[model samples]
Target chain A: MSLLSRKIADAVSAHPQKGALTVDDDRYEICLELRSADPEIGVSFDGLDFRALDASPRSVETLKAWGERLASRLTYLMEPLVVLEVDRIGTEVELRSAKPSVRESQLRYYELRLESSGAAHLRRVLFDRDTRTRSTVPCTLGAEALERLVEDFTATAA
Target chain B: MRKIESDQNRFRQIVRGKIKSDLRKYITHGEMIGKTGGELVSIPLPQIQIPEFRYGQKNGGGVGQGPGDVGTPIGRSGEGDEPGAAGDAPGQHLLEVELTLDELAEILGEGLALPRIQPKGRANIIEEKDKYTGIRQTGPESLRHFKRTYKKALRRQIASNTYNRNDPIVIPIREDKLYRSWNPIPLPHSNAVVLYLMDVSGSMTDDQKEIVRIEAFWIDTWLRSQYDGVTTRYIIHDAVAREVDQHTFYHTRESGGTRISSAYQLANKIIDAEHPPIDWNIYVLHFSDGDNWGEDNRQCVSLLRDEILPKSNLFGYGQVESPYGSGEFFRELEEAFEDVPNLALSEIRNKDGIFDSIKEFLGRGR
Candidate 1:
């Protein structure tokens, strides 16, 4: 196993479920979760929660491969820093931009969700400030773009 | 004149129908809220026209059939197609019809099937209004009764042998001037006060505040229509709570942890000082994102149970959804205050949820 993956696996074994650890790179805070003997890893940065696989094994090599896969997908996230949040309730996963766009009085945000089956979906939302109305549209992201988002969410800090 | 009045009444009915058909859109979208002016709101209606009489000139020329040829083209057809500067006259436009608040409230009531609120207890507040009782000899010129003064002048002219019976002309002097006088009468006013408490913490965004704003507008509109005198107060809270004006209540934002009990405490104090349960019909609406400091949730429940709900005719708690909020406070309240008639709890997902949330709050007719 790679040196970094070995360290993460050791840290996960030492800490309790839902515990956080800043490994080789202190810039990224990795959160470890265990459900039904399967591991879920996430990262917290800039008060925003991001990245959590539905389920995986606690293998050191698997952690390394997943981290590398995420790192290779860093193509999106080329804009200014905006707060985002990921709160998983029950089996549903909700990852949304916490800071909405302040255009005129209207606010807009992008939200991504992962169903229990691990399928990802995206939505573009618009909220009218004057009227207090909201409208949402389903959106699509290319495979590479989705990968880039996963990469940015899993490892990066802003 | 009667025919013209009848036509005008028919036109008004048409406008009311159009407004009623689109009332759901207005309530859900809040497009009419910004158009409110005093007690009247201007609504834009399309495809409605006002009838007018078109007069023709006495000497206007007309074409004779004898001079027209079978193959003749209309004069200057090419000239009409030529490009020119924009015309001075305006093009077709949407008509804006102004409806009073009472009228709008009636539309809302009928459109949503909302039951009219029953005022609790007897009317306790007294409002004094001016009644035009009689005429006086001396007063402000703006209030002068010209018709009465002219009749008085005609009577005096005939009595003094200065009347021109054939001409029938009478001019009034300064001594003939009369003014309208008023007497103050106290009437019982059914008074209601809506105490609005909002959580302006970091978790609550402008979007959520906007939902609060739209809901508040509808609630205020319905309550104002029900009560003779309705007074509104605004309170904003983060970790600390304070009373503010209406403008500041919706616009203000603070980046601090939420302590909902602070707002309830202030509302309790306000009720004790200005509005007593016996004399005032109190409505307490608290809006938050359902995020609070862990220990503060218990305090908020206690405050609601002991202080706010007991005094309020209806206590509505709306949890506006926010991305940053944990949304645990809603469950806590539901668990603590199950089946409490005076307490109404609703979860507002977004702007679209406002219509039903308002119905839920006022449907009780409290």
Candidate 2:
């Protein structure tokens, strides 16, 4: 295992939400967002509120190794998600997901806006198929909020 | 415009994905070499499906809005129709997409998880360059700024109250012309030179040459992306070594015996005369069948230890497997200099081995 993978695994294992919370019939996915300066790790449940945590790097090699490891982790995490979206913020990896209720016809997408100070804000939106209209949804839902939203949306949409 | 840009970006992403997925196949094949241009390579991708509005058959189809007789020909048949076995599958269409060498290198690095090369020994050289800094009033017509000249003419006409709303034409006079001016600026640029030495002895078959050619193309692509200016020199050796053009480097066949020291000697001379160790990042890559004169092995090792390895950023030895040649050179190099930092060695047994050979040669990020 590379240093970056070790660090990411350590961070994920030490997080308060580690294996303790489940939302939308899936476990919370942990991600490490890398940057050229002052890199951080982020964790999200439903592609929102990617909480950034602090990290330290020994050199550029560690950063590059971290990126490769993070990509592998993201690929593994995406295997079970209904919708997977991967983007980059500078040198960082931004992963977003949606519940299975949001079908492909809904044209769902997510974006993360990273400020200069290294804070990230995630937004998710879906388009209506019949009306050709777009509507934004609050993506920063916690475990309880995500569970309720997924249950309600699944029940109502079905 | 935004929609078109978004579509273009999406298409580029799809192309990248296709290239990444078939990277190993591409590394082993030399089809893209013929399509390469100065800084861009055209890759033929057969798997990318072009999206189009495929029309379906209309219900109750008739020529004149009425039902036609069954088994009746409505249109004339072409003359080329002949009795042959039918193919139920749709024909495949290949799309040739142009990608800059930088983009290709990025994909190679990401796909192989290759580390970024940290250039050693005076990575940068300062060169004077001309930059178009600002506009001037008098210069050659080739340097004339059309938009600036038109704007100047318009401003002059408006200031003199000679603007015509009817014609709406502002002709620029000599005084209103603007020309681009340049200034000499000193720029630091990273320059690299690749020394490609290949064994073209009787034992090295055409298949081995083809493998060397394919691997060289990809290595050149990746290295060229890292440096500002990359110069490639080709040397083909049997018993005697001689410099050759890129075309002759891969196609030539020699009947003489093998002597690895000749190529190294010529490479050393070339570096000492032209590419000095203090000014350029040098990469020395040699492809052979791991066969050499029994006595020359010690000379080759001594030359590498004394002259080549110290001056080179990387010294890569790729032993292409051949049935006619005894593969002993790689074992000698490994036994002598296995722990060297800049020396990278790999055994390429066939086309499939080119992928791993590339990884071994460039994995260290030298």
Measured by DockQ, the strongest candidate is: 1
Writing each residue's lDDT as its tens digit, candidate 2 over B1-366 gives 698799889989999999999999988888898788987899999878876656577744655644667676766677557787899888876788999989999999999998888776556556889999999999999999999999989999999999998989999999989999999998757578999999997667789999999899889888987777789999999878999999999899875557889999999999999999888889999999876754889999999999999999999999986642235788789899968999999988789999999998888887
Q: What's the TM for model 1?
A: 0.61
What is the TM-score of each predicted model, taking all chains together? 0.61, 0.55
| Model 2 regions lying over 4 Å from their true place | A1-158, B54-91, B121-126, B131-181, B185-190
Writing each residue's lDDT as its tens digit, candidate 1 over B1-366 gives: 698899988888888888888776677776778999998998888767776676689646765675658787868566678688889998888789998888888888887888877777655457789999999999999999989999999988999999998988998988889999999998757578899999997678889998999899988988888888888999998777899999999999875457788899999999999999888899999999876664888898999989989999999999898753336677799889988888888889888888788888888878
Question: For residues A61-80, what per-residue lDDT tens digits would candidate 1 score against the true structure?
Answer: 33333333433443243222
Which DockQ-derived CAPRI band holds candidate 2?
A: incorrect
Clashing pairs in 2: none
Question: Ten residues in a row with the worst lDDT in model 1 chain B?
Answer: B322-331
Least lDDT summed over 10 consecutive residues: which range in candidate 2 chain A? A80-89
Residue B120 in model 1: lDDT: 74
* Residue-level error in angstroms, candidate 2, position B93: 2.8
